[model samples]
Target: MKKLLVITCFLLAGMGFANAQQTSPVWPGCEDADDVKKCFNQKLSKHVQQNYVYPKNEAGEYVRGKVTISFQIDENGKVVVNSVEGAKPKVNQAAKEMILKIPEMEPGTLNGEPDARNFTVPFNF
Candidate 1:
């Protein structure tokens, strides 16, 4: 009886997890692609690397640090930068700007309804 109970619990938990998965946001150029999530991630990394600009301090020395930029894709599919953590002011600002440059995407969905989803990107400079 105890074993049956445990198995039932496990099955229930698996069903809950399967239903909890949300639909990922569609990247601008990946709208027609089969795998939106994977394409979005790949494009995001490439975008950050391509647009990254190292910040320079007053003495013209390169700012060396890292920041984790957090943002959300709102219901309208616009990128809204929420916070930047663990970096100098200039570094943080640069990271925010870079993330903001991401083109508008198709908003993520939860249960077939548009929803806001958070994402994080790390920048090392």
Candidate 2:
């Protein structure tokens, strides 16, 4: 009976920890969004589509590659590109430029305090 009581206590404590709330960084127009995360994703996709530029090789052929970009929305609500990786340098540079164009907005929160949020996304060109 003592062991059962201890296990139940532990489980309840774990549940409390699991329920901690964390929020994603809010996009510029997502201040009143019902689902902030979904809104953020939609805004990010739109920004990428609008800002993406295709790179061309010396022969004027379009460069084809995929880039993985890692970035963070800082506690001050600024976009910072952490890294970009791709087969070709041009592709990486293009992806980096696109991510850098993201506008600053309200920072995300962890437990209701401003917190930085990291994101990794892939781009194809």
Candidate 3:
């Protein structure tokens, strides 16, 4: 019983430590600015708007769909697409391409050390 209590305390303390140390990656130009997270999100939205092209079907009609894209900013500051959900294949491909074009950023940190972090965005057309 005493061992179990000690393990529980350790686990809770670890969770708090992890949460306290988590930090989001900063976009290229926002590295030194205040509000890094807001800057990162704004840049991300602008990037998608500038680069994402909704694919057209064989009939030459634009495919209207929403895609939820998941990607990771790796320790090297490169975007690595993990998955795309809820879109046609062409739309998914477009989403992936746009995400891949994200410029290298300063990777996120955990406990003051670089860490890979996942980000998700939804594209609606």
**Which candidate wins on lDDT?**
2
Per-residue lDDT tens digits for candidate 1, residues 44-106, read 989988987888998999887889888999998999998899748888887888888988988
Those runs of model 1 whose alpha carbons end farther than 4 Å from true positions after fitting are 1-21
TM-score of 1: 0.79
- The number of the candidate with the highest TM-score is 3
**After best superposition, candidate 3 residue 59: deviation in angstroms?**
1.8
- Residue pairs whose backbone atoms clash in candidate 2: none
Clash tally, candidates in order: 0, 0, 0
Q: What is the lDDT of candidate 2?
A: 0.92
If ranked by TM-score, best first, what sequence of candidates would result? 3, 2, 1
Q: Candidate 2: lDDT of 78?
A: 96
- Evaluate all candidate structures by whole-model CA lDDT and list the values in order: 0.87, 0.92, 0.87
